[model samples]
Target: MSGGGTSPDYVFAPHERPLLPGSPATPAHPTSRRFAYFAIGVFVGLTGGFGNAMVTTNLANIQGSLGLYSDQAAWLTAAYLMTNVSMSLLLVKFRQQFGLVTFARIFLPAYVLVTAAHLVAHSYTTALIVRGASGIAASALSTLCLLYIIQAMPAPWRLKGIVLGIGIPQLATPLARLLSSDLLERGQWTVLYVFELGLALISAALVMLLRLPPSERMKAFEPLDFLTFALYAPGVALLCGVLAQGRILWWTEAPWLGYAACAAIVLIAAALLIEHNRANPLLNTRWLASRDILRFALVATSVRILLSEQSYGAIGLLTALGVGNDQLIMLGLVMVLATIAGLAASAITIDPANLGRPIFWSVALIAVGAFIDSHATNLTRPQNMYFSQALIAFAAVFFMGPTLLIGILRALVKGPNHIVSFVALFSITQSIGGLAGTAFLGTFQVMREKFHSHSIVQSLTLADPQVAGRIQSLGGAYGKVLGDPSLRQAEGAALLSQQVTREANVLAFNDIFLLVTVLSLAVLVWIGIRQLRMYITGVNPMSEVLAAMARTRGQ
Candidate 1:
């Protein structure tokens, strides 16, 4: 179990051991080593997130460059998530069986190779293959980030490292949006991949130069693990495809969507059935089916759905108004700062006795933020969203750490064997939650836009003097360009229709914002009621479970 050299004279605090079995034992470091670890952690974490963030934030531009349609661009994102989510389940065991060194050695080089492929191929099929590889690499890098962060901190502050490791990646989207405009302007999508490739190489180098301390390894994999993964991985991929493409292909319009959904259900169900019968299952279906775990999944998934107000709602609205990423630089800056603030706040205020309170506050802030955004007008720009978007951004990171810890505490309480189950559960809920949220909100916005467009068109009458006056005013703008009055009138009418469509889109986005607000508040109420019930019954579920876990680990 020991490494080649004498192990560092370091010890893990009881609370930290349950996080992962092969986690490096933390030796107290001098200020310089600590600083290096911190820097490496941030770099690794950001690199992991920024890889996908660059593609996702600039999907449209990438699509245009590759001569792809909307749905094709979507497949890139879906392909990434397909492997990213399912890989986490196998990765826990991979780390346990083979150790961090092997995990990184395999994946990091693969990441670089994949990035190189993306740079060279520049084709749709190649892009899909590379993205799937990137997803696996991304999962490894995220784990590496946490490992590095844990090494940086002293035992007393180790938990704070977890908070930062998880929360820092959330900043990538904003960072990507901030930098993508410049990257695209300079050298188009190639510049972006070159940058990612450079980061991949740098991350690999940094990790090699500063290796984590070795830990105990075990023969963690079983035959059934592979069988479960074989069944589960494709099932989740199919579901991810369904969710990602459903809105783009218009749900019922695509026959493939139905078939994919059905296949996903059958595959996942069969996997679960196999696990359900196994004495040593990978997924721990019964524990996951328990009330507390179900509730945790629901709350986690609901928060993800509500968080889409930023991704699908506000961003979509801005795009409709022709506001590009260049114009939203300040907004992205605000989000990054707010996310840092949230990370600090969560770390400082985390309490096992009341882990749910931050979630409450987070949901409240999201609701309030969404409500503020609901009143946006045609003139609304990125500047108009600064405060409200920051609130949501803060809440987004603020809630994640505690939610993760809650599940971790419960999983560790049961036993180390349940760790894989928790990881898989958390990954699926967050990934599928985001996907489903985007699909639902996007579809809803489209439907609302259609309704609003119909209503607005019906209300507009050429006989109305006001409408006539507006048409004349619009026509006057074209007088210098078009000699014929008939052509001018036609141009004016087309412009008016464009205006109406813009208005409808704005109205639809407002409705989406309101829906997010309503859902947030409703979830808040549901959580609050459950918390109150627990209090009245004199039973603190998480506290009791966490305490037992500590005692068991201590023993």
Candidate 2:
């Protein structure tokens, strides 16, 4: 099982909150007031989601204006994502040591400054630096929102809140895309960040007004084992970097890249083992061994792989087909349907009984839809393209709603420690999965094209009488069009080469779709086997919450 970030569901724990030395300990509020606070957190988190997605969709335009190449332009997105994923764990200790109020107070100002920096960012290097710092604050704030929501809401409502909190980001993509035109029309992507900063200001106001229960607060942190966390950070960074770069750097021969990746993984694993044996570990690995969290991590890994393929792959395919900016906006806009569907699905199904069913079916839809999308090269047929895009959107609704619900349920079952680890591990794995899938698929497309070209060329270079006559005839036609006797041979060769390239491209794309199908099927089989084994053992995975207390004690 993957162990990464804290589970927001752990906020529901009834432990008394500890206060900072000078900070006032706030009394717990009535359920009504607490729910109101939870709502505010959702609003702030959703706002961030909207801004984050807008920045992602607008990356291409940002690169064009800033003069960054494809790989360099990627740093903006990668930096933000990496910071968010890596630093979340750090906040867990800080939130405990400083108190939520104090942490928010610190992050708020930094957030404003970073947002402003992005607005006036002049170079790729500068923008990434600014984004990296801003991302740290954003990550802390988001985790705070999750922690607060879990603390404020009742147990029954906690899972749904987490689901909505997570779902908001997924839903925002389409909405942001729909609004991309108006934002882009205003010149530069600065306008989006301005809106984000405004939202942050609003969140700051809400945070000030709404007081949290002392019971929900964290205890003062002891001195961290920096030696251990230090090991984990670079390890995670390298592992993700290698996966992200492997496809780009040709996998094996990019300087010290491969060696560094191996070393990082080895070091990180060793450190984790060392930390796990320590009295106060960076991660609570003992709690992580519980069946629920471990199984949840496995499921999350699969879901992430699918999500990576869908989001990154879909975006690249759409852009590659020469889709207009307006169309791209509309394409993303369709996700609202899925988000709404997820929300509705959550409302009807709260008990853990039917949760896994939706997850299974949704993943199936994602696999099938993505596989179809891989074969989506008939861009001239608008109907066909829309059909493919719609299927993907619909599948996303199924995939996201169910998977998110299951994750929240798992977090609820596992508690804060496991939740944190799960999220951290989830982020790390999903990032790796997406980068790996895109790179592999991209390289596969290239390789397929080369093979198709060779075979088709060999077929074209005929010593056979019939093939030779056809080639000569094509040369004659080319001579007629150019009316230049000397240039006829070269023109005929160029025409044949163009035709071969086009055919090769189509075949390569088809192979990508076939591979996606195989991936989806493999996921189903894996999940199915696990479920069958659980059934045979007569142990409900969701039932592990009953033993969570036992697991904690053993740890």
Candidate 3:
């Protein structure tokens, strides 16, 4: 029960007391309830991830169905991230001020309505509005999943639930890839939204039926918080716009990209300047700028960036070479299984005492996977990629739990105030890191493809006898249908040109693989060196933090 408005404090039984202002209490549940909570968590986690996952993995189909240009389709994704990223800054405080149950009651039903609206949203503008609303509403889903999982697990393993809950949403990507083909076959882009709406309805009903225990409320929102957000939200939205559209619009070719970048910098800088001086800031500027937090953000962002080897490298290569999602069902299954295994392995083997080790292995696995993929030829198929993609998928989920737990522990050791900062920092790293990875990798692939295309095209001329023979052989395939000699020759030349383009794309992808490999190895060495230095100096960075937590828990 909350105290009067003066104290902003509460008194409750230890078991019923919330760990934080916005979070639900950890009161023990009956066995059946725990099982129910676990099941709900799994479903909720998948539900949280699937909506955006479908849009991303099936963007091509959605683009065609909506008759949207590539730039326009990209905005669907940009809109989601734009609203999703900055909303966390407010959502955390909303729970603290209003209580999570009320937070859920409001957002969950709103999310369902927004998802249902997605079904009738045929126009691009309406779809964009729906996506923005979905982003704002769906921001609550991750918290719901984590809360449910925390309730499912007992106290000692409570941190384990946090890790699993954080990682569980990742399973949606592979699952979406596995299922999107069939969903697309069922209907148009709206069909995917139908599936999403169904999942949302299920999750919302579950949450309503099994509401979380009451949480303590506090007057957490400051008047300046809104002012800070006004500056921060637009800054982040602009950055998301640039990253989401830069590669589509071609960064240097678009003047607005430069303008957006400059505007984003100014806006973000102004917000940080305001927060840096505030006694009670929305974002903890000093804590986030600390050495340990900075390192945590870097390691977390680095792994997320490297994880793009699967999405941009393998999937992009396959798409370029005309491989369909239908053909990659088996590969998607492999990835789904690998991701589950990684989630289990990370949860099982997690040593809170040494969170960095799992991250090390994750980066190592990513390096090996990328190196193997670097050898890819035009002959590479989904089957050719099964093992490599599995490695990256496993690494992607594997790194998440430890990386998350590490920052979470550090925040807990500091104080409850820092938890908000850590959560916001973590969310930004993940959302922006993912967008940056796709944007950077896509840009790199495009540039490399042009170079390879130029080199390959320079060598092909009618003067070469082999070239002449291949063109004649290609043109012969059209001979039966075409009566004119010149037309047949022209068609054959066109086919040859297409083949050259495909080969160049393959080469470009291989370069991307190598690029990720190099980056992974570099991150590995950097982290390894720091780890070794800590060992040699007998200075474990997390030991004091963990001991502090252990002492707190013991009391």
Candidate 4:
């Protein structure tokens, strides 16, 4: 007898069985039990993302509190992602071999212990170790979130549950921002770790209290799996390290960055070469490189990069404008609320027959928001950004569920073995894609800032009366302390230079917004063209695949 109840019908009907090995059984539950499952899903999803989100929002504060340099601080994020991005490749297999209940029990408790270690460990090395451990553990919770939500919803609404489950963690980004000022006030960076520890503890306890239904176990791992991981893990870590530190250290100036990049290429190529010959490969490189999968990967990665408009663009602009976390509380609140609405909207309106539509709308909404933000000036503040940011926030969660569903359905159509490959593709596109977006945009902004700075400085001449007068007015404020006329004039010129630098930064950010706007529109057009082609041809592979899925469930 299965813990979920009787043996699954898949015992007789193989076609309708769990899509992948060791996936949680979906037994019927009472109303109260279902509600409890939903509640746990929300909490665990929040916990999964809170650790990284809190650290990211308060990076500068954490850096100062630890006496770390700018480049050193970037490692904290890089460490988390280094492990986080590649774990999904193995996590599906872990669940397959062990079962979801065991998987949760193991990772959640380890999460608590690692978090506590972080609380006690003050050194940079220990912090990086703990952060990386946290990533491996938290990757499990996203799976937990999905399984719990599946148990909560009726069979018909399970897709909605998937949407909510995937999107719930995204809420943590803005939520962390909203709560950061208060948490830091409670204590320095330690309080943030303390808070994360508390969440991990509660989550661990909650899992022990209510267990997931039993899943059938399998002998999923091979000796070569370990070898593949050894090479692949470090390759990805090095790649993530390079991306995280490139702009901070300036790509060309850092010799190690070049060495790391070359090493990453070799290691990853070797791993894929090994997998390419395996009868049961961990990563299906050939499948991933297929035309349809390639398109999906492109869209997934590009959208994530463009979505950096909110994280690296809007937040960067406000920070440049001298706004602090405390001042931007309301903006964060607006994003949180808008994100909730987006999730709700996506869930309620999901059309399994037309999964691609939300992606189109998401890109369109982002394009519009970025266009609005491209017009910002020195006078712009968080309040000025409320609407555009809200629109982008709404679009952020709005597309996630549908995007995921498209991938999920497509993977299921390919058969059970492909599940690991799909998880890897999806996770990489979401996590690594976000990091790449920030790195690319940050580098673009810096280069543009230099360009604008030079252009603005070039336009200024002392012979221009307005320029000389502005300098005199700025220097006048320093007159009480510096009586020398030459000193006052020099001070005036310095102040003028500061204003020019600030304006140049603002202009550079506007260029980023415009670049994002154009990219978003182009992607939207590409998706639109594909949809148009499908309609005109009256032939669709996706329609056939969806029909197959419906037929399997019906049987």
Residue-wise C-alpha lDDT for candidate 4, range 1-555, written one tens digit per residue = 233222454342343345557776666678999998898888888988897999899999988877899999999999999999889888888888877766876888888888889877788888889889989988988778777887788778888988999999899999999998998898878898889888888877776777776676788899998899899999999999999999999999989999999999999999999999999998888888899889998998999999999999999999998999998899999999999999999999998878788999999999999999999999999999999999999999999998888888988877777888888889889998999999999999999999999999999999999999999999999989999999999999999999998999999999999999999989999999998998999877678879998786676
* Model 2 error, position 124 (Å): 2.1
Off by over 4 Å in 3: 1-12, 550-555
List model 3 lDDT by residue over 1-555, tens digit each. Answer: 221111235345676678788887777779999999999988988998886888889888888888999999999999999999999899988989887667888898998999999888988999999989888887889889888998999878887898899988889999999999998898777888889989999998898788777777788999999999999999999999999999989999999999999999999999988989999888889989999899999999989889888988899999998998899899999999999999999988988888999999999999999999999888888999889898889999888998988898998887787788888899899999999999999999999999999999999999999999888899999988998988899999999999999999999999999999999999999999988998999988789898998788668
After superposition, the stretches of candidate 2 with alpha carbons farther than 4 Å from their true spots are 1-39, 144-155, 209-215, 218-220, 286-295, 353-355, 380-419, 456-503, 533-537, 547-555
Off by over 4 Å in 1: 1-19
TM per model? Answer: 0.96, 0.80, 0.97, 0.96
Query: What shift in Å separates residue 106 of candidate 4 from its native position after superposition?
Result: 1.3
Worst 10 residues of 4 by lDDT: 1-10
Candidate with more favorable, higher lDDT: 2 or 4: 4
Q: Give the 10-residue window scoring lowest on summed lDDT in candidate 3.
A: 1-10
Tens-digit lDDT string for candidate 1 (291-386): 989999999999999999999899999999999878988888998889889999998888877789899999999999999999998999999999
Name the candidate, 1 or 2, with the larger TM-score value. Answer: 1
TM-score of 1: 0.96
Model 4 alpha-carbon drift over 4 Å, by segment: 1-17, 551-555
Q: Whose lDDT is greatest here?
A: 3
What tens-digit string does per-residue lDDT give for candidate 2 at 181-285? Answer: 787788777777777778777777776666444323445344555666677777776766666566556666687677878878787887679767867555667
